[model samples]
Target: MVPPLALDIDGTLTTPEGTIAPRAFPLLAAWEAPVVLATGKAFPYPVALCQFVGIPERAIAENGGVALVDGHLDYAGDPERVDAAVEAFEERGGDLGWDGVDTVNRWRETEVAVSPTADEELLRDIAAEFDLAVVDSGYAYHLKSPDASKGAALTDVAETLGHDPGEFVAVGDSENDASTFAVAGESYAVANADETAKRAADRVLDRGYVDGTLDALRAIRDRAKNGE
Candidate 1:
């Protein structure tokens, strides 16, 4: 049996404006393998996606910091790690912008979104100083728990399903997807992906954003079903 397929949302499976490609739905429905939506998008977002693609309710949200498994929230690992990290971030004079920590709660389970103005240099500094991972997701910077990551979340889902990470395919298109690309047996990047994402990917699709994602998903389903 093929292992599960993990996908990112914002620049991978969906357009930046949150549109799902028309062709993606049928292809996803036809595929026998579990297609896990591993995304930074919050709860109801995935609910809408499930309705769109006709896939299972399982999803990795908040950049893998939270999981919705069989219609319940599965907080990954210890809760104290998240608390300590947030406290330390605050102590260091980290300005979470206007919304403050409430913005983090909105993502569900306390994964904070740093200011969009916080660039890679600042992220690196925060990471080095706080011993926390700052995931750069284009529109926002995510201050995540130490255990939270796309790859780690994918691993958790795969293990729960009794599958090996080496057998799974991952599709994504940003800095947050770095670890995910590293872990998956196969990795793909959309045409609109950043230079770093393209470099990390095993295959870069010709299509762009939602359309590209639809094309890629169709290709994966075809290849998986027919051994093409």
Candidate 2:
């Protein structure tokens, strides 16, 4: 069987214009392995995207803060812990309502995504204050529990679908995706990815957005056919 593909949302799936590439939907449908939408978007958004793509394989949302299965959200982090983290973050003048890069804090559960201008160390300190963790998600920094992560969510869903964590092709274009890259047997980063993510990936695609993702997927399909 072809290994599953764990995909990042934002910069990886959408073009620079922030629209899903027209070719992406069908390619996702025809792919050999399961396609999991792993993103920082809220739980419902990715699930809705799955419906739009006509595939409901599995989805990881909120930067690994939760997993959506069978139309129900499976909370991956302690709500109380996350709330405490949020309080601490705000008390230190860290904005929970940051919208610097076209992102809003509305409707997000378990974790909060702040503007890119946020101080990483300060955020980490806040997380540490509440025994939580802060992760960089390319466009923003995320505050979540230390154990809640995209890699763990991917592995969890992969196992439910009868796949191994190491047999996946994780693809992304952000620092948050580094965790997924670390766990996957193979990882690909889009041309627009941050340096940290590019370093984590096994290969960096020449193109950006879903086109580059399709390019990588087609390459993977070819390698599988060749028994490579």
lDDT of every model, 2 decimals: 0.72, 0.82
**lDDT (Cα, 0-100) at 74 in candidate 2:** 69
Return the clash pairs for model 1, or none: none
Candidate 2's C-alpha runs over 4 A off are 70-73, 99-103, 118-121, 226-228
Model 1, stretches more than 4 Å misplaced? 1-3, 16-18, 70-73, 77-94, 98-105, 118-127
lDDT of 2 by residue, 1-228 (tens): 567889998999899988877678887887777889999877777888888888874889888888875545667887688777777777877765454553455677878777778767777887777788777776677788778889988888777778888988999998889989999999999999999899999999999888889899888888888888
Candidate 1 per-residue C-alpha lDDT over 165-200 given as tens digits, one digit per residue, 9 for 90 to 100: 777788888877777888889988888888878898
Alpha-carbon deviation at 78 in model 2, angstroms? 2.2
Model 1 lDDT at residue 62: 80
Report how far residue 182 has shifted in candidate 2, in Å.
1.7
